[model samples]
Target: MDGYQVYRDAMTKDQWQGWWVTWPLSTRVRLGHVYDRKSDGVRRAGDLAARGIPFQREHGTPDGTFIYDSNESVDVAFKASGKTPAALSALTEADAGASVTFTRGRTAFVVFREYSQSGISDVRGLSHALVSAWWNKEWDDSLLAVTSVVAAAGATVLTAAEGGAVAELKVSASAGVGELGMADLALGASVVRHSALGAQWTGTDVTPFYQVIRLRKNWLGKIVAEYGPRPPGRGALPSALPPLLSEEIGDDPEAALEPGDRTEELPFHDPENE
Candidate 1:
C-alpha cells in the first residue's frame, strides 16, 4: 500500500498529464477504470462484468436507455439482455438531458447519465449510472441500448413483508417474467465530478446478486431520491429490494405493518441471521 496511486480517464480534450500529475484543488474526480480484476484495484472495476446473478443486466443509462460501452480502455463485456428500437433511438437520436429507465421485474436498476444530443457529456456526477447503461459490448461500439418495453406479466414478481428483504420471488420457466432481471444491477453511486453543467459521475460499481437478507427499510430512500422517485411507503414496493452490502441489524421493518412486539417479525427468517 506504500506506492498506491489512482487516476481517471481524462475528459476527451485535456491531455496535459496521463493521470499521473495531480490537478488543481477544484479539479473534478473521475473513477478509475481498473481493467484487472486480480490487480488489487477497485471492486468490479474492470471488463467482463460478473454474471450468474438472479436479476438480469441490461445496457444504457436510466435516461437515453441506449446501451453503449463506457470502457474506452478496458476489457469488460457487460451484456444487455433485451432491447427495443425505442430504447436505442432514445440514446442515439434523442436530445440530451432526455432520460429513460430500465426496470427488472418492477424493480428499478440503474438510471442513465444525462447527456446532450451531440454526446458532449453532462457527466458532472454520473458514473455508476453510466455503468448501468453498459450493454456488455466493447467500448461504446459493440453495445447499444435497445428501447424496447417488455411487459411484466405471468411472471412471479411478488413482495413479502414491508421494508425488508424480498423473502420470495420465484419465476417459473413455463411462465417467464417478461425480461425481468435481464440487466446487470449496480450500486454505490457517488458524484465524482460536478465539473460541468451536466457532467457528473459515480466511480465505484459492483454487480449485486440477490440474497435473502433484512433490509433497513427506507435506508435507500434518500439515495434513490437523488436519481428519481422512490417507493411510496415502507409497507410494500413494486420492485423487491436489493441485497444488503453486509449483515446488519435494526428494528424489524415489519413491526410497523402490524401492531405487536413485532419483534416476532425478526431480523431475518432464514436462520442465517438468527
Candidate 2:
C-alpha cells in the first residue's frame, strides 16, 4: 500500500496555518559542554523553562549500564483542526502550561503549549556560536525547514501536499573551521515517526522550532496528563503608546484596544439593566 497524505487527503485550504512545534527537550551534552553536571542540569533546565519548551524529565537507565537524566527528547507534532479560528486564537491565548483543543473531521486534536528554543542564543559558547554563525549566513533572508535525509526537500515543499518533509537547516562555510577552530564540527539528532490521534506525525529532536506543544494523547488512545502550575490568564492587553510626535507634554494616553485584545465581560452591567 502507498503512503497516504494526511493534510491533503483530509484537510482544506484554510487549515494551512495550523502548524505547531513541540517543546524542546533539554539536549544531552558531551563532557565538553558540562562544566558541572548538577549546575549544568539546573542551567539547561532553566534554558528550556525560559524558552517554554515542554519536555519530559527522565532519570533511568535504558540498558541498566548508564543512567540517563535530563530532557532526552521533545514530543513534536503538527496540530490539524477544522476549528481554524479557535485554534489560531488559542495559540495566542494559551500559556505554556495550558492545552488548547481543535476539531478536524469530527475528531478533536489538542496541543499543549510550551516555550521553544528555536532561534539564535545570545550566550557566548561553542554550540551557540556554531548555531548563530550557521544561521546568520546560511538561513538569513530565507524561509528554512530542516529535517533528516529521509524527509529533506527543496524550497517548494509544502506540509499539506507532501505531509512528510523535514524543516531544512542548511549550513556551509568556506573554511570549515571558524574562530573556535573546530574544523569539522557537525550536529546530528533523531527524527521519529508517530501515528496516532487520527494523525500521522514525523518530528526531529530540535530543528529551529518556534512554538512548543504537547499532544493530549499517545498512540494507544490514552490522555497524557501533564504536570505543572496552571499559567495565569493572558492578562489585560497593553494599550499602544502615542506616536513619536504625540509624546509631547499634553498628549493623552490613548485608551483604544488593539486588534488582538481578548474581549472580556464588563465588570458592571448597564445601570438601566440594574
Candidate 3:
C-alpha cells in the first residue's frame, strides 16, 4: 500500500478531522492562500472571498484540520486519477504552450508563454504594460483590474513557497523610449522601458528576488517583443519540507516505506529534491 494510504488508514474519523493531508505541489500552489499557520491546516470555509479563482473549498471538517477538503485538492486528485494519463494533466496543459496576443501598431503579435515557474515572470511584464497603457488611455481599461489580480496572486504563490509575505513586497516602474527588435516584432522598433517588482524574503537569507516586466513598444505606442520566460532555478527555501505535512510524515518517513511505494514522486515529500 502507498505510505500515504497507510497513514490515512491508521487514523480514526475524529483524528482525521483534525488534519489536512496533501501531497502534490501543483495542488498546494493552487490552494496556497487558504493555509493557516496557526491552525496548521486548510480553512473550512468554501468562500474564496477576494481570491477570485473559479475553484472552491470542499469536504472541510468543522475544525478545519483537513487539506483535502479544498476543492482544488479534489480537482488535482481527479486529474491524477486513471482517467488521465498525466499526473497533473490539467495544470500541465494550462502551462504548456499557452499564448496571448497583443497588438503593436496595425500588426498583431502572438506570444507563447506558460505560467509555471518563471512563466509568472512573463505575466509580471504583461501586467505592467497593460496597466500602464490603460492609465495612459492607450488601451482598454476593462482589463486593468483583472490583470492586477492575476499578477498579485501569482506573486503571492511564488513568494509563499519561499516563506515570504506578499504584503511586504516592493514594486517600481519606469518608462522610456528605446530601439528594440525581436523575431516577434519588426527590426529597429522603438520600445517602451521595462518595469520591475522586487520581492524580499523574511529569513536569514534576505536576498531579494526581482521580477522584471518587459513591455517593449513600437513607435506607434503598441506593445511588442514580449518573450523569454525562464525559471529562477536557484533559491530553494532553507527547509525543503512544507510546514503543512512535516508533523504527519515526520523527519524521515520514506525509510519506512515498503517496495513499490511511489511517494517519492510527490514534491516536498522528497526533501532532497524540494
For this target, which candidate reaches the highest lDDT against the unseen true structure? 3
Off by over 4 Å in 2: 1-108, 121-197, 200-274
Each model's lDDT comes to 0.21, 0.20, 0.21
Model 3 residue 2 CA deviation in Å = 1.1
lDDT of 3: 0.21
**Which 10-residue window of candidate 3 scores lowest in summed lDDT?**
143-152
lDDT of 2 by residue, 159-211 (tens): 21122222211112321123311111111211122222233222222221121
Output the TM-score of candidate 2: 0.16
Question: Candidate 2 at 21: error in angstroms?
Answer: 6.5
Decoy 1 TM-score against native:
0.14
Alpha-carbon deviation at 35 in model 2, angstroms: 31
Candidate 1 C-alpha lDDT tens digits along 72-91: 22112122223322332322
Provide backbone clash counts, one per model.
Answer: 42, 9, 4
